[model samples]
Structure formats: structure tokens, C-alpha cells
Target: MSTTTLPDVRVARDEQIAGALALALAASLAVQNAVVIWVGAPSYADPMTEVLAFHADHRSAVAIAVGLEALNLPLLLGLLVCMVGLVERRGGAGAAWSRLAVAAGAVLSAVFALYAVLWIGVVLAADGLTEPTPLLELVWQMHAGAFALVMPALGTTFVAVALATHAGGLTAPWQRWLGLAGGGLLVVAGTACLPIADGSSLLFVGMPGYAAWLVWLIATGVRLVRSAS
Candidate 1:
């Protein structure tokens, strides 16, 4: 007896479409998410802190940002799985186990998103709902878990995956590098929180990286969108 297998063109196309959209969404979301982090991690000692800082004072924005973080996992994972699904259906094409990269990013992004909610909640709910005291609350917030540390790990990992898969694809090498670096910053910024969460110290060291990473991803997404169109 002989077994026959056929390619599901419809499924393949759907996966491609999903992958593209997810990439675009991830890019857009990264920028928005970073803005929220900056806003959420605002310090009281500085004037900018009292102004853009919302975690201690603005529950609504905190909640909104937190909610966005929560969605990171599903969106990332869905994109990754679909991306992988496309790879498999096409052939043993790209890098080995590229899906693992997606998995790393999806899992890590999810974890970070979840903890973002927890951390923000802790900051908002602090008993000493004032300027200086509430500032310390942010410090206590870092130890919540190594979630911050892992997010960057995932971000960088996803960057690698994107590069590997695009080894010869239409994506420009420069764009790929930009994404890889952005993802790296996400992880680095999160990890640096390990030592200091006291007053926005993480912002100085990590925000630039995180911000760059987001911008890079957003740029890549724009390229992808433009290409598709």
C-alpha cells in the first residue's frame, strides 16, 4: 500500500497571512508597551516623574497597559505557531527547529506580560500612596520574579529566529539585525531590573534598549507591511 500526502495551499496561505499580521502587531505593540512601561515606572523625585508617572496615581492607564501585556503571549505564540506551521507545510525549509525560537519568545513575552500586570498592581496598591514612599514600592516590585530577566531573553531569541528564517528570504539583513537588537534590549532592560528597581534606575539603563528594540521591531513591521501591500 502507498500513502499519499498533499499540500494544503489554503492552510499555507492562511499561516502566511497570520504570520505577517502578527509581526505587524508585535511591532506596533512593542512601541506602545514601552511607552506604558515608562509611564508606569515613573519616579516621583523628578518633575517628569510626577507628571508622566501614572502607576501610583493612574489606575486606569496602569490597567490598560497591564491588560496589553497580558495579551503578549497569545499574540506572539499564535504568530510563531503559524509561522512554524507555514515552515513545516512548505518543506523542511528554514533553520532547524525555528519554532523553538518562536516558542521562546511567545512563552517569555506571555510571562512578562502577566507579571507586568502583577507589578503594576503592586505599585498601585502600595499602602503609602504618596510621592517618596510610593517610590520605594517600585523597588519591592523588581523582586517579584525573574520574569523581567526572561523577557529580554525571549525578545533576543525571537530576533534570532526571525534572522534564521529569513537567511535568504526577502527580508533585508539590516532589518533583521534591527529586530534582533530590539529584542535584545527588551530582555536586557528586563534583566537589569534585577539589581535596581528603586527609583527608575532601570529606566536609565534599560529604557533606551527597550525603546530601541521597539522602534526596530516597528520599523521591520512597517517594511513587512509595505512589502505585503
Candidate 2:
């Protein structure tokens, strides 16, 4: 009956939207990682002069980093919206998970955006300022601290997404586990910030956890694409 088939049509439509968004999100994540690495960014503890010098010399790289990070914000929001829609449409407690995911994603996006903005400021002032070392150093520390501190928000997002996917059968069990495990690592990275001063070493968890998260995103995107087809 036409009535009976209506639900199927709607479900298919949701899958198509979710799939497209997921794929875009995956690409954005990959581009961000590539740009960051290509820029040869300095560490959190690196001297302010060293940091400014790097950006000043490699202005183009700085621009690329800023652009890619900013670009990821919208892509991330879109991805979360699509995923939440899919979960809500499936009808259940998954809605709760979806809400949590959105909240966490929003926080993560904001933090990343702030970090990107600081980098933008750094680039803009790199050539102009003679006594910018103190200011630059302060911004550097803030940016690094923000980056490390935001891991928990991202971890929460991952966990909520994993729950939603499990409930909606959106991804495989192993993939869900991968997400959970990655999230746990992020939590560890956040906790590693306890001493604050020694926080740079804690970044080890962030680097590996982020890589894992990216892998999970790629896998999820593949599934979404397959479903759409």
C-alpha cells in the first residue's frame, strides 16, 4: 500500500542526507589534519619567538591552517545535524543521545573556531608587531590549553554518537566500539591536563585519539555512502 511504503521513502531520504553529510565531514577532517601537519606547527611549549617566526615565514601555511580549521566547523555542525535527524527519525531513546551529541559537537566546534581565530590573529600581526612576543606567547598558551581542554567535549560527542549509531543500527558493532575506545582515549588526554605545565606530554593521547577518531569517521562515511547507494 502507498501508506505502508511512505515510511520507507522517508527513511531512504534521511539516509541519503546523512550519508552525504557524513562524507563531507570525513573529507573536512582529513583536510584539517593534512594542513596542520603540512604547516609544521610548533608545540605548545615552544618559545613565543619561535612560534611567531614560523608563522611569519610560512604565512601561506598559516592561512591554510586557519581556513581548514574554520571550514571544519560548518562541516562538523552539518554532520551532527544529519546524524541527529537520522537517529530521531528512527524513533526511540536515541533522541537523548542525539541531543547530547549535538551539545558536545557545538562545544567542540566553538573551541576549534576560537583556536582558529587566535591563529588568524597571529598571522595578521606577524609582520606588523615589533614587541609582539609577550602577546604572542599568551595567545599561544591559551590556544594550546584550549586545544587540550576541549578533548573531553569531543570525547563526549563521540560517545553520544556511538550510542546513537548503535541504537539506530547506523554502524557496525566493531565500529561503535572503535568510537567508544577513541572517546575514552580523549578523556584520558583531557585528564592528563591536571598538571597543566606538563600538559604538552599529554598531547600524545590527543594525537593518537584524533587519528583513531578520523579512521572511525572514514569508516562511518563509507557505510553512509553505501546506504545511500
Candidate 3:
């Protein structure tokens, strides 16, 4: 009896940790967006001069946003690993989907890391520069392109995980549909990544989808914690 109870306790603890990580990641992403908005970060379509000025004026805010992203990366990985564990333990039909989710999520995390690094490079290049040099513009462009490319990875992870969770009986039908729809939008945006990197308005297509994902994360985290309790 003691041995059985010990394993149960451990499982519960793991679930709680996973839930917490999900919530933390959502919060971190929300905060990073807030920082970007607060600092009035320029769009890729904005003139190079405007982009340089924004970076120059809001170095501290950009730094904070980057720091949050750094925190978010590990939280994302932790949550993904935990979700995979849950799916494998209870997933019957979902095993394949979970594997796909983990693979896509790993790519998403890697791309996001690259995005963050590119932003860091942009900031460094903009430092002490009165005008936007060609090199600075180039780095900034690379950053924008990296961000645009992240959409596909994010969409794949979102869709795969939603299907896996649903197959494992961890999510409702509505939740699964929501993930599919939202993830689809992101993928659509990814299809036009080249234009988006040039500052195309199509980037907005992924915003709502990403918001849906955040809502899903919050709801899923709550459910996981409740179940553990």
C-alpha cells in the first residue's frame, strides 16, 4: 500500500509542477508582449531610422523583453516534457501525436532562441550609432525574418499537442477544435513569412491564433492542477 501511494504522490507532484510551468510560460509571454507594446517597438515594415531610434530609446525595455523570452524558453520546454510524459502514460492512440508535438516544440524552442539572439544582436548593433548603418539594418532584418519563421514551428507544436491531448482524453472536443483552428491560422501566416519579414500586415493573422493558444495554456494548466489536487 505504501509503495502504491508513493508512486501516486509522485505523479501528482509532477502534474502540479507541469501545470505551474505552463502558467508561468503563459505569463512570461504575455509580459514580453506588454513590454514590446510599452516600448513602442517598431514593425519590420517601419523605416530603418524609426527602428534604430526605437531601439536606442528603449534599450532597457528591450532588454527586459529579451530576459522574459529567456525565461519563457525553459518554461516552454519543461511544460512540453511534462505534457509528453502525461500523454505517454495515458495516451494510447495519442502516442504518435505526442512524439510529433515534442519534435515540433523542440524546433519552436530553438527558433525562438535564435529570434532572441538576433534581437540581442540588433540592440548591440544599434548602440552608439547615430544612423542606421547597413549592418544594423541587416541584423534587424534577420531578426524580423527569424520571428516570421517561428510561426510555422509554433503552429505545428500547437496542433500536434492539441491532437495528442485530445486523443489521450486530456482535452475536450471544443479545446481540440480551438487548437486546430488557431494553429491553422499560424501556419497560414507562416506561408507568407517572406512578405511578413518585409513588414506585411499578414503578420496579424497569427496574433489571434497565438492569443487562443495562451487561453488554451491557461485553461489546460488549471485543469492539470485541479486534477492533481
Q: How accurate locally, in lDDT, is each candidate?
A: 0.56, 0.76, 0.87
Q: Quick one: how many clashes does candidate 2 have?
A: 0
The C-alpha TM-scores of every prediction are: 0.67, 0.89, 0.95
Tens-digit lDDT string for candidate 1 (3-74): 432344465355456546556556547655666666555442344235334545666666666676656666
lDDT comparison, 1 vs 2, better candidate: 2
lDDT of 2 by residue, 93-164 (tens): 477887899999999988888777877777776676655576666666666767776787788888888888
Distance from true location, Cα of 3 in model 2, Å: 11
Better of 2 and 3 by TM-score: 3
Off by over 4 Å in 3: 1-4
lDDT value, candidate 3, whole model: 0.87
- Predictions ranked by TM-score, top down? 3, 2, 1
Q: With candidate 1 superimposed using the best TM-score fit, by how many Å does residue 69's alpha carbon deviate from the native?
A: 1.8
lDDT of 2: 0.76
Residue 132 lDDT in model 1?
39
- After superposition on all C-alphas, the RMSD of every candidate to the true structure, in Å, is 5.7, 2.5, 1.7
